[model samples]
Target: MSSEKQMKVEAVTAPVDLGEGPHWSVKEEALYYVDIFNQNVHRYHPISGNHSRMHIEGGPVTLVVPHAKVSKTFIVTVGRDLAVVTWPDPSKDCVITSYKVLSSVDAQCPDNRFNDGKCDRKGRLWAGTMGATDVPDNPNPHLGSLFIMHNDAKVTKVVDKVSISNGLAWNVKNDTFYFVDTCEYKVESFDCEFLRGVLSNRKTVYDYKTSGLHPSFPDGMTVDTNGDLWVACFGEGKVHCIEPSSGKVKKDVDLPTNSITSVCWGGPQLDHLYVTTTKKGLSKEQLLAQPLAGAVFRVTGTGSRGYPATECNVSLPK
Candidate 1:
């Protein structure tokens, strides 16, 4: 068993429908997340009491992170398309690059879209995918994939046949890359070789048990300064701190909303932990009880900045 971690909730809120990806914008000293159904970008601050939202004309902007160096600019995905939006510029308008969409080949149904995503240590963008709707008739089971978009306008299908491709992370030592099979309720680790864009020796790193405690399927995940994985339990209103090497849950933080979706570490000193939740599949009682459903929340005592996504690096001829 790994050393135990303490967990607590500093704030309770909700977002739109699916709050999957959580990223830290260092320059803004705040966290950015998406409401997949609402097609909006949310910003939250833990220290200065600033929170707001901007509507983007897209179906689901899953992940929004710095598009380049700290210039208040970010790159995001609107359904099957990618676009660039500058921050501090806070304008609803965005600039999208003309990059080819991920192939809509066999096994990849059309209704599906991008899910949990992050940039690697080398400034490459990585994100997972899943069927657009998770119902009985989707027929797209295991149709999702893991993808990497090189700065050179090339994208690689790292892994296919994923059901819910959520929660992507890499250890601080830069040796192992972590992935979450959200629907499978498992987290796996692969050898870290960003330059070569390779994965090997895939092993189960974490699993959410549903017996003793009703931990929802783990979704978007990030690693903290101490190398612990902070996982957002989708069905359960909670986040987990676990040791990846041993697959042991060290601590659990309960969220006010029952369906907490994702988490991240942000702030000037990297001590604030931000979380996002959903209000999509809820009953009247559940919605009323968790009125802040689909809102974003923050908490202290979680300590350490998890990691920031890298922008797809574009190199110009020298």
Candidate 2:
């Protein structure tokens, strides 16, 4: 099957330092995402050009989604724990959850917050980890693993040895899951059983190129209406649209900044593509030059919206 030829970008916010997870709230018609170093999650409206921020009383926030424990609830991943926030109103009345750490291994270091995550069809939270040290000299994927949390708050290590867990997307119809071992610059797919929360038969669905106009590493991603995988390149300055089955580059949307972190499909028809980026880890000289590097941007062309993330089941022992 042949796809489109061009990609476009619309600027939303400036200097999105490590813009990671982008999720579309259809009912609210708002786009939600986090700027990792900024310690904030931003809500943006495309047509009205209005946006708002929720400044957490903690370190950087990496990902946001409809809350796992409650309906109409939202999950905000603070550094070490997942907080539940109630967005009863778009403009006001938000209560943040003081949740317990659901991961089996506790986070004991500073700066090591949850990186990227998504809820599977059965509403199970699948989150990835990064190192706690924020220093540049210590660039290692320390203790990073992919985890699954059930409704009871029981956490299981689905996979380990991940450098940076940045991307999670699945094809429900095919029972196929696409997971990203981000620091390695590739996307791998596995067969999944929703009821059992198990994965098997893994293979490389899409491997990003190191030498090209394509982005540096795939950060956050979502599947399209046509099963196309849309990935945000953390240092590459663009989103790589790929055919997951064939591992072919269909198109790449260029952005003004170099750190494109997360992406989602939105718009009244779910055709609008929203991207979050970062300015984190850049040298002082680089920051001055790319002052607005860590901002958010939008793009539209495929006329596809993202699927809503289901409520994750955290199976806790009573």
Best by TM-score: 1
Tally clashing residue pairs in candidate 1: 6
C-alpha lDDT (0 to 100) for residue 18 of candidate 2: 66
- After superposition on all C-alphas, the RMSD of every candidate to the true structure, in Å, is 3.8, 3.6
Candidate 2 lDDT over residue span 66-120, tens digit each: 7545555567677767656556554442434344444534455454557789777
- Cα deviation at 59, candidate 1, in Å, is 2.4
lDDT of 1 at 92: 34
Which digits, one per residue and each the tens of the lDDT, describe model 1 over residues 1-318?
Answer: 231246456554445777757887676666777777677777766566666676666467788866665465566777755556655554333333343343322343677777778788777778777786653234557877888876764667888888878888888767789998776677789997766788888888765553334345777787887899988877767788888766788777777887877887777776777888788889999898988887777777654555554554533122
Alpha carbon lDDT of each predicted model: 0.70, 0.70
Off by over 4 Å in 2: 1-7, 68-72, 87-89, 92-104, 107-112, 133-139, 209-215, 283-291, 311-318
- Per-residue error at 253 for model 1, in Å? 0.7
Which residue runs does candidate 1 get wrong by more than 4 Å?
1-8, 12-14, 46-48, 70-72, 86-88, 91-108, 135-139, 209-215, 303-318
